[model samples]
Target: MNDPSGPDRPPAARPRVRSDLDGLPLFRGRAAQSGMIRLDCNESPLAPPAAVQAALTGAVQGLNRYPDNAAADLTARLAERHGVPPAALSLGPGSVGLCAQLIQIACAAGDEVLIPWRSFEVYPSLAGTAGAVVRRVPLTAGHALDLPAMAAAITDRTRLVFVCSPNNPTGTSVSRADVERFLAAVPPDVLVVLDEAYAEFTGRQADPLDGFALVREQLRQGRTNVVALRTFSKAYGLAGLRIGYCLSAPPVAELLGRVAVPYAVGTLAQRAAAAALECEPEVRERCRHLVEERERVRAALLDSGWDVPVSGANFLWLPAGPAAEPLAAHCREQRILVKAFVGEGVRVTVGTAAENDAFLAAASRFARTEAAAPVRSAALG
Candidate 1:
């Protein structure tokens, strides 16, 4: 049945690629600094270690050939380092990609995902792009994960819940007890994702439910919804390699592996990641320095009259809220660049001790000026 205007019929409305992405750079909101005291992105300040550098020198010979489609060596290294089976892991360009894949596995169009307000900003956006409705739960006064409210927000539509421990921009986490209670309250079919990118920096020996342990625990309890994610980008200083992973039940792992882009972790990344896994001493020392600097920097800021939480990650969170833009601008002018959230707060990654000193100095000046302005206004009144 050919219609008169069949050839001229309007093309069907094409859905834009992935719903929300408009060919925009994902990290567009974060300010960039070509060279400055960079405290914005939570990236390691140092270059790759000598061992990693040597490995890269060796890996250059293979760039011409296709990378390992399976990223087999890195997967085995990840499993061995974390004490999980290689079959339980799925790799990606970064944890963000892994999160996207997890959302794909867990949610159907219009299904809902739960994300925390003061946590990683990408959560809601990624979930939305995956055809899921994003459910945002605000943080508690202490800036910690609000488990009770999050649990209440859960409805039949909910499918995935992302828990970013030492949560980005906020720097707090759910306690072990809280995690257990939250798990108990959540339904079995719903996927719970625990992102532990900052886990290595924590000084404490026991983290209530280590994501690695949760995978095995969930299995022992006949559950299939828990997943733990980690990355070598932070402590290992491999941010440029774009390698990260999620651990799940073997079935879920299989699904994630199938959905992820083949060879997402390039051959170089695989080799470097494998080598990094064995350099525990180096990684641990760097993290220790970060933790120490986090304390020193936080103390310096507080002593100089800045309200901030003691961080468990490699960064500090300042409730700059309305002060964010100005503070960031001020820091940039002083040759330092720190993280800022429009109406939320600011996050400052711990750089080298000297770099941290420079940032603190800039902040002190900002705080002093702010302090004197009110007094001067009062005098005029």
Candidate 2:
């Protein structure tokens, strides 16, 4: 008999992958390039506070042991900070990770997740990964979430809805009153996830929605569907640590914890995040400065005749339409990186003063060059 392990032996069949994932777009972070000023990923321009850095250094000694699976200490700190019971909070690697858990807990194959188009790109990917049908509600003419349309789009099949305030790419936020009205239209059984990753930067915006406050009220009223997600990556400068938390009704939080990967939030991240909470004053100051920089950059772009929308987040949206890719290309050529959304627009993160100035100069040059050229159709044909 021929040996089964012989070189000419028949190859074994490859393991099967989920057919639904074939067309799914993978999310990739922009790689850092030496000498390139990156204003593409919406990251904090500053370093983490000294206290947080110190905490990380101290945490390194405990690497031989496993992280606290429950994240007890950090959870308690967050509970006190938000004035909520520890039972109502769940910690994950990041708000994005929490988002995936949220989808897992709420959706099964063929269930629907309602999201605004061009808001957070991850929402669709996460929902799709769970085999959930994604219903994209288009943004309004002003590049903002159309709450009325989204409310109408919900059906009995809808399992979850993601409301991204000061939305990711557009930087347009809905008012608290607007969210309250939208909530009234949504069925209580369907989960509404308030993604507030940039909540710390919304202090300067008019009528900003306090997601935690809203969730607290909902919990008090015995409603358990509304959940608030906050991340330490943006204003807290903990992007590298990958720590975030969510506030929801105790039952929802319990579900999230149950579905979370074992020890998802590592010891270093937990310690760093807890230390970050103690440095709230420093975090607030950094956010204040970034918000100011955001406004200044928007003003400059507006003066250059760019249809820049008012931004409440740490970035600005340039609704360049068909010019989006070319504009991003031009900035890239100047050794500056900005995010371009194919036919939609470009999102430029606010950076240090010098870096912002460099980006501004490149943008001005691109504007002048485009002006000197013949006008192209919006279709780019």
Superposed on all Cα atoms, model 1 deviates from the true structure by an RMSD in Å of 5.2
Q: TM-scores of all models?
A: 0.90, 0.95
lDDT of 2 at 217: 96
How far does residue 90 in candidate 1 sit from its true spot (Å)?
1.2
Q: Residue-wise lDDT of candidate 1 within 1-381, one digit each (tens)?
A: 657579967777886656345632365755455678888889999998889888888999989988897787778877777787888888888888899999998898889999888789788778767768888999988888898899889999999999888789878766667788889999998999999888887676454447777777877787889898888789999998888888888899899987887767788888888888778898899898889888889888777656787567888898766677778888989888887788667889999989998998888787767633432343245
In the predicted model 2, the residue pairs found to clash are: none
lDDT (10s digit) by residue, model 2, range 1-381: 778999888998978989999878899976758888889999987889999999999999999999999999999999999999999999999999999999999999999999998898888889999999999999998889999999999999999999999899998899999999999999999999999998888866567799999999989999889999999999999999899899999988899988999998999999999999999998998998888888888888777767787887888998887778888899999999999998778999999999999999988898777531321332133
Clashes of each: 0, 0
Shift of residue 44 alpha carbon in model 2, Å = 0.7
In the order shown, the candidates' Cα RMSDs to the true structure are: 5.2, 2.7
Tell me model 2's lDDT, rounded to 2 decimals: 0.90
